[model samples]
Target chain A: MGSNNSLAVRCRSLVKSYGSGDAKVTALRGVDLDVREGELLMVVGPSGCGKTTLISIIGAILSQDSGECIVLGHDLQRMNETERATLRGGQIGFVFQMFNLLPSLSAVENVAIPLLINGTPQKMAESRAREAIEAVGLGSRPNVLPSELSGGQQQRVAIARALVHDPKLIVCDEPTSNLDHDTGVAVMDVLRGAGKKHDRALIVVTHDPRIFQFADRIAHMDDGKIIEVTNGASAL
Target chain B: MLRVAVKMLMGDRAKYAGLVFGIAFTSFLVTFAASYFTGFMTRGFALISENPTVDVWVMDPAVRSVEKTTNMAASALDRVRSIEGVRSAVPMALGTAEVRFANGQFQSFQVIGVDDATLAGVPPPKDGVVPAALRTPDSVIADPGGTSGKLQTPLRPADQWPGGGPRLDVPTRSLTVGDELLVNDHHVTVVGKSEALPRFPPRPLLYTTYSNASRILLPERRRMTFVLVSAAPGVAASDLAALIEARTGLRARTSDDFKADTVSWFLENSEDVGDIAAMLTLAMSVGFGVTGIMLYMFTTENLRQYAVFKAMGASSRMLLAMIFVQVALSALLGTGLGLGLCAIASQFAVEAEYPFRMMWFTPLVSSVMVVIVSVVAAAISARPVLTLDPAIVFTGR
Candidate 1:
């Protein structure tokens, strides 16, 4: 563990159930995890193994039947929807595997969305978006739309969007699953670079093994529970 | 984000064009149809109304409007002229006469006989020429199409006496632009052409001096058909109408009241106004329908992106704002184009002698309708977008 002890994301005794009695399907059972500030962590699991459910709960996009999820020092269950959304906007960023960029927006415009949503003036938001896009090595492609970019470039734009708001935590759901191996590595490099430069906690949830090398730590899960945890030294 | 939504709506050339086209077409139908209804109502009382220069219009207490009915009396004209606010009162008579065109065809015409000294109730041409008495009693001031044989005066079908062979005969004498016409064998001359006015059941029109019409239409009778009242400046027509109504027990109405009454009469008596209103309503409905469909498509197409925004920490308010902005922008553009088209179309209609005058509220009202429909459509489309799971983007669901 790093020396600094600021916890960016924490979950304790999280219990999530799908149904009751005979047809019950437990997605998360008695799980606990802590992600420290400035660390890049990868969550690996087989399909339907609850890695997604854990990330969802941490992002405040889903609710756990029973548990405590304190993300960026705010308890998810204690806040109302509006309060939670406000906290989410102020403290978190999200990147999707599909590079969910708005088709109507240009690369720079897509990156400016989070700032715009947070009520930043358009000029300032666009300026900040430009910086984020440049950080992802897309300095010259700011005006190109998602459709005009390759898979790798699209994901870079998604990364630029996630970092544009300067949030404390970045939760990425399969950020590189759709990309080819080389493009996926390039995207992960950009993500790790941003995480380290910004000193924010990054949690990437995916089943892709190719992305494991960019993470400082890895949590392995099976059957709704973490089976093993390893550091970057051992992951390599 | 508003800029983004706008760019998205305009990004696809075909879709944007289609959306604008649909909206403009819907707007055209709404304005055009409404204009027709409004124009028809205006035509019902256009004769007495087209002249705003006349300060007051007085009719018998029993007459709702100057066009629909008449009362026999020359006494009211002299009495009205003696009132304090009255600047002048002129005797004007509206009657139907048979005009024999040069082609030997005869047609019914609306003949307005006004006093030569004070053409108070006469409709002047665009150049504002008052109709004067012709040198001869047969001459008449006529509109271009007023000479056509197609002109037919509207009258109750049962009012015609079956035994009376076409009550009046065609003038045997040939007439020129300034020549006299033997109307009912009484010679009357053409003064000059008055401005063309549209009538509900269109007929050719003629304008002559008041004395000649008094003798021709009421050959055996002793008074004018109606006396028009003109109040002095600063006097209210309503007060005058009240004065005339109280004194004579004749149905006296202000000009506006008279016009409105005529409109109500036509709406009640004829199916034209009602049919036009129904068609205008249908057009408005179709406009709403088109906007709804276009907005629905726009929202549905952008749902996934909306979900992404939500996942990226955008609130429902922000998403809704984006939608409203997109729709408002589209509506403004469509309304602009539609108003332009309506203006062009109105020019053609007017040139063709089809009465169409666009009101000031048409564009404002139509734009409001479009925005309302857009909001409802956006709200419906937002439901699916609001429910989309952010996790699905990764899971392939």
Candidate 2:
């Protein structure tokens, strides 16, 4: 972890809920957390425990109903949709559980999306995307479509996509949930190796306890609130 | 992003093909219907089209179209000739007559009588035969359209027929020069064939001199149907037409105006026009319905990918543009394919002499309709995508 003064995310009593009236359900309940820069923070919980909701608010894709949730020093509540979108496109990145690579695009093209979103020229974006794919050990098959790649390879491409723009924060939701044990660890090795930069913070939401050793810090949750925060392999 | 959008659209080959097929089918049917309608309107004024030399036609005030005319008096020609813009005016007698073929079969024909002096309203003869050939005693010119079917006569005499009687199985041939027929019991000879334009409701036609026509048909008090006029130098055809109408109290119209009037009359009075219009409406409706549904389904199926894009920080405007680009591509490709098919079909239609004409505006109109379809499809498909919450990407929903 980085110095105590260098905080990448700071949340104080954050609350979030879904639906209205009788159908209403709270997903996050007054959660307080701090993530330092250059840290791999793994959020572990049972199903419907609000692990996804906490990260969603931190990722700037969802808003908290109350309290402060600051990501990279900008209060998400104070930002409008366009400003939040700009922040997400420029400073933050996402990795989905499904390895949501656009099935039609080649591996390199999928990795190029973030840079393209930031208005990078096509040639420059694609060249940088090829380097990113190469870092993820997919340089030889950059032109292969996601459908033609193995599950682990596809997830590596997804990781490459998340890191292509060199965003300050990367939020991954169940990044290895669909892979076998060996492939899951391999994908995590690639993700951790490529994602942990000096200026970047990675928050991974996962149900898998097998990869707990890979985290620098682990936050355990039950229901809608975090119960405990433990250091790295000590959580095991 | 545009490249990504295109790849996403064409990635689903089946849906893309379906979308194209739907649009293409609509374009083809709509274009074909409009072209057929145009061809019919053109043929409605076939007579006015054939007499390109005549600038105006003066007929009875009640005459609304060339196809249905009320005969004018003989003095109508002289009255039109005396008009200020008139250069020359001649009488034309038009009537339906029953003609008995040499095979003893009788068929109805639209007989046209041109002025004996100038043969003013006669179409040029085919096979290099001159208009003066009609000056032969009892001579008339046949239309090529008529000789092919309605004016055909048996190749041999009745004795050569099976069972010693006129047989349907016997070979029949088209009427050529020197063929004789009985018109109202008077003998007439086919002097030559004329390259006449095909009529709307096709009828066999014969062109004869006014004197010869008068001799063959039963005498009527008003034998002149129309007065064909030429505009004098420095005079416009429209000016001559208006002047003739004012002085003679007749319906005097420039050839182009007469064609427009004929088309307007058909539009107002013809059931065929209504039928074609209904078919065109049905085709457009089917196109809208099918293409819209297919596009919506395709968008819905790929919505997950869109959600991912949104999660990746693509704005609503960007997603909307992507959908429009997909639909526009489909519209362009489908419209091209449809029009190409129509063009090929039109060739066969022309060869078979079907009422089909693809004017310059036909394909343009079809393309415009396709654009409208594409826009509608895009708008409908974009609704859900624009409203989607990017947070769904985390929910695994």
Candidate 3:
């Protein structure tokens, strides 16, 4: 989503090629996009349209071979892997499509992980994690494991995990891809509510057009490049 | 933290099993090998370990231990008798011979010829050796040293001499108890079975008069191979040894010195024993190495999960401590079980007549080996963990 004078993400000629020279797949080809602080943006595309790859680059989980991706005033291309990891942990939270919760941990424990990683005391982290879990409407099931929760409940736990650390940006990759339409709607509502309530930038990558209604802006991708950027209401 | 570590390790029962089994196998190998070697060494001292009744062993100056055959003229006995602090020195003769039993079966045996005068070892019930009886012309007493003999009536005084002469007649055919048999095919023996020192060897040992054994077994008979000397109540062994050496110019060894020398001789000369010991040591080392590698792999596999905790912000030191504690606890379980098994096996070995002795040091040595193996295993396993990127939680690919 574009903000008039406030920028949270900046990219320039970002190029990411997989594999060595002879047998390579270019996931992102010199595409650039900007996300605004406190904005809820949905990146929509068909499969293999570089939506996930672009999000990965923005979140500092993957590197671009050339060009620049600046997030929170730090250049992802120049920072070492370790430095990127630190920045990601400190400022970014993630919600995966499959709800990647540690199977051994309870919902609250899963949520507390990022906080724990950030050196929060266990008791304090778990308490904050409980608040986030409750905020997602699963207050009573905080002790339940991800496997024990419904598809929507699991997604909420993932969202809680991402938000409990109070990160500046939330990167949700296909947050509703594994859920039914009703559960997907519920997950998007929780994600939007949490994003707006905390004033954190939320970037959701998805192929499902139904969830575009929850986005403040929509960015469409095709042939490994973003072809259109518009207000979500315009796309609807 | 320890509880978490324990739960995590126990949660994957199969992985912990692999680590435990490796350590258990190593413990068995190291413990068994040390015990076996120590048992073999102890076997050499079984017969005369206590040094009963006598303190010093007088041998040829060249004889370092009992394994070496020493010779001294019997005339040396007189000189020993004259030495101060020397209570008495009894002459003993040792030789090897082929004995043809009544069944016409032949077997080689070691013979210890003692002075008949002392009856020092006459058929049990009679303790001291008597010269008067041993010197009874051709009369011979057999105190079992070689083959176990049967008891029979003492021979007739007149028959003690052969053809009514001073020497007895040698029998050509295999004979029964009381029947005359030639010793060295020379002086005949009135075979008398004694309970003392039975199962000594296969050949028949005749305890006859020194004079008779001299005439029968030795060409010179002027020297005796050994003199079992018991010291006076107040005289120390070194004093007696010095006294005897000064008077007789012969070497004297204390019982412990003789036993040690004998063991050294055996270790040097017996290639089979040394080879077995060397092979066992090599096998034990290989066992330890294999266990170490296996443990490292198990820990390596589990280290992926450790990265999850690291991503959770657990310190590298904390994670290492967790792995080490897990390994140490598993090793404790495995080694405890191994030692228990060894103890049970040792008991069975004793009952089954296997010469097995497990000294306290055996387990100590095994524990040290286990610790070393575990440390090496942890080191290799820790490599994967130390290099783990906490970013994997995010990359999730």
Candidate 4:
């Protein structure tokens, strides 16, 4: 553990459920995890293992039935809709399983959405988004929409969008599931560079083991709970 | 954000174009209905519209419209002229009579009598010198052919007539300046033809000097239908009208009040007005239904994109603003297109001699309705967006 950096997320006894009564299914039972700034954490699990539910709660996109969950220093369940939305726009970034780039917008415009949502001026937002796209080495294809880009390129654009505003924490769900092994490694390399920054942390949830080498720590989850976490070097 | 909203809308060209079409059609219906009502209302007051120079019309108090007025004593015209603010008041007469044509067809005609000296209410002749020809004692002027034919035909079906009515063969030309016709068993000459404002049931028109009308019809004690008045310089017509009412003990109304009174009277007395109003109601309902349904469908189809926006940290307020922007742009473009259609239809109405009068308020009312359409549509479509959970973007469902 790096003792110098501050804690980015603090969780205790986090429990979330779906539906009710006979139809109820528990997605997260009781969980505790601490992610420090400047670390890349990977969560690996089988299907229906609640990895996405955990990150959704962390991203403030969902409300847990009961929890002592805090993200970016705010309790996920206590904040009102507006406050949580503000926190989501200004402090957190999210990447989902599929490359959910807005098909209507060009790559640069899609990348600029987070900054624009944060009330950044369009000109500056686009400039910063271009820089983020360039960081991913897809600078030449910024003007085409997601449909025109390859699967790997679209994920890069999604990553560019997530980091375009320099968010403090990024919660990524299945960042490389759709890519081939080589393309997945390439995308993870770009993501590793983006998340290894000194001031931000990334929590990526995926079943793809090829990217385990890029993480500083690997979290193993099963049956609605975290079963193990190990240093990446030790796991190798 | 607005740019994204626009881009998203453009992404679905079929829905986008469909929404615009729905809005434009609604706008056209609303605007055209208002204009159509305005056209018919003005037609009800066609007498005043055709004689715009008359500032006031003086008649008996029971007169609801100029066309349906009770005759007053000729002395009422003298009393009107004697009022202080009355610039000029001239006696006028109105009558309906039957004239025998050369084809043995006896067509009915609406006759208007103007002052012999001033021709105060006579429109310019369509075929011959009007006031000059009207000065001859036996002369009368008929309307141009279309109105003349319509008016000459009795409104009821021919089989319903007491005598099964007159047979119409080849339609005869309108009474030109040289035609002779027998009226009330006396021969009268058609000295001129004049263009008059058209009325429903198209009345055949005749214009003659007061003396000619007085001798042509059966003798009656009262010879005047209305005392047409003009305001003196710097005097408001209403002020002159009040003064004339006080002096003459006759009702005097400014042109605007008279026109409104005529329209209201038509509404009360005629079923045709009710039919027009029903049509207007139907038009608005159709517009409302179409716009609401189309906009709601658009929102439903784009629900996933909105969820994606919400997942990307777009607030509910932001999502609503985006929808409002889309609706506002649609309303503006649709209203413009609808008004353009109205303008084109107006041109066609003019060519067809349809009694249509377009005023500023017609378009103004339609634009207001369009705004209501946009807001109501937006409000309805916004509920789905507001309820959309941003988490749906991640569930991969």
Best by DockQ: 2
DockQ for candidate 4: 0.55
What value does the lDDT take at residue A175 in candidate 2? 87
Model 3, residue B187: C-alpha shift (Å): 12
- In the range B100-121, model 4's lDDT, one tens digit per residue, is 6644467787778888899877
Model 1 DockQ, alpha carbons vs. true complex:
0.47
Go through the candidates in order and give each one's DockQ. 0.47, 0.62, 0.17, 0.55
Candidate 2 chain B weakest lDDT stretch, 10 residues: B159-168
List the lowest-lDDT window of 10 residues for candidate 3 chain B.
B145-154
Deviation in Å, model 3, residue B198 alpha carbon: 16
lDDT of candidate 2 over B248-322, digit per residue (tens): 899999999999989988878878777876877787788778877887888878888888888788888888888
lDDT of 2 at B176: 82
Ranking by DockQ: 2, 4, 1, 3
Q: Write the per-residue lDDT of candidate 3 for residues B140-222, one digit (tens) a residue.
A: 65543323333222244433323433322323332334555445665354544443433311234456655566666647534
Which parts of model 3 have CA positions greater than 4 angstroms off? A1-9, A13-33, A41-66, A69-90, A97-112, A115-133, A136-138, A141-159, A173-176, A205-213, A217-236, B1-4, B44-271, B278-290, B303-319, B388-397
RMSD of each: 5.8, 2.9, 8.4, 4.4
| Residue lDDT tens for model 4, A1-236 | 33346889888888989999999999988878888887888887888888888888888888888878888788878899898888888888877778788877999999999988888999999999999999999999889988999999999999998888888888888889899999999988887787775467889998888888888888888988998989777766
Lowest-sum lDDT 10-residue window in model 4 chain B: B153-162
Error of 3 at B21 (Å): 3.9
Report the Cα lDDT for candidate 3: 0.71
Q: Give the interface RMSD values of the models in order.
A: 2.0, 1.3, 4.3, 1.6
